[model samples]
Target: MTLKMSGFNIHIVFDLLAASLSLVGTYLAYTWRLRAANAMALGKLSTGYGIALVTGAAVGGYGLGSANLILSEIPMVGRSIVGALAGATLAIEIYKRFRGIVGSTGVIFVIGFTTTVAVGRIGCLLSGLEDQTHGIPTGASWGWDFGDGILRHPVQLYESTAMAVFLVGAVIALAVRSPFFLKNGFYLMVGFYAAQRFIWEFLKPYTSIAGPLNLFHFVCLSLIAYAIYMILRSKDART
Candidate 1:
């Protein structure tokens, strides 16, 4: 579909808002009556994001660029962050309601974050990156010419496939309602994604902000730590 509505191309905003509203609504329904649906977590996630956005905008504005940059070149950042919070919140609530024992409460946050990245990055691809240096260079017969033969990997599709796999695994795992998933699902998917994103980073072109704390390596390390923490905590909780 064309990525324009009227003249303003706010695909990222709409996607984030739509996905968050839809998923949160689904979750509320799943809980039956849409009551006590982690209003606090929702507020906290929004507040956290607001803080990040404001801080980032301030930095950008200081650098002579508008704060809009933080909200640009991204797909569903606001929406997915909220969704992640919702997922994590619902996870703990679900665990309490069904299992009658507390499990790693934050696991769903990781899962939601990963899956949303995978699913929503397509929006980025659709809108196209404004930065010239962001993907693989190509000269083959089948290479796409995004105006400069910057034959980049379809990292979006790659991630989407991985995420679809992760989503299926998550649903199946949840259907079983096994405590193991409640503890380990977040880490497993995140750990796998860390490696995948790390490799994809090489194929990806570097950005002006591509420093030691760039996207690929950063996501990898963070997820690995989260995975390890969840598993370790789950084990400890059992004991």
Candidate 2:
């Protein structure tokens, strides 16, 4: 559909808003929820995080560029958020292992990340076929036209809804202080998000990296495996 608003593209507006608000929300969430964690582990958290950010962005950019996904060809700033998340997770795990930092440092980020993705995906939906995030043609009643003649699956909206559900569920888990959930909240979030994304990847009209899966599909599988390992390892450690 032609998502024009007052002579401006609504998708661009949402993208800008999402980026701005997500940054602010992430900072606030970190301060409000992880201040104590930071205080307790004040050993180069900032420096390590800076390194992690750089490495994550690099890895993500490389993945997207190599796979030719969306905007990975535009200089150095084009990268998929999904790739960034996968790379960031790996980088953070490496940093944690090298520094011997223990415990879940990403609890607050669970909500922050989910909320950011949920908001940002609205822009992807509005961008529609112009953006590579659009799904393949479908005949469902809920499918969108996206300025194209063929109706396509609204995968962006599906992901946004999934992220929203995860955010709400995570908050409730924190409020209840579920032992396992609190302990492995980050893993749980990653596992759930990756699982959902893996399913949605099939709907997207992207180049496949393997026989039947795209780059994101492989990334999501890796995330799911890593999350499972983390959860199991945490259990074993407790035992």
> Which candidate number has the best TM-score?
2
RMSD of 2: 3.5
Clashes of 2: 2
Task: Give the per-residue lDDT digits (tens) of candidate 1, residues 164-210.
Answer: 67767766666666557655665676566666666666666543245
Write down the lDDT of every candidate, Cα atoms only.
Answer: 0.49, 0.75
TM-score of each: 0.57, 0.84
| Model 1 accuracy (lDDT, Cα) | 0.49
RMSD of each: 8.5, 3.5
Model 1 Cα displacement at 78 (Å)? 13
| Poorest 10 consecutive residues by lDDT, candidate 1 | 60-69
For residue 81, what is the lDDT in candidate 1?
29
Off by over 4 Å in 2: 1-9, 23-44, 65-78
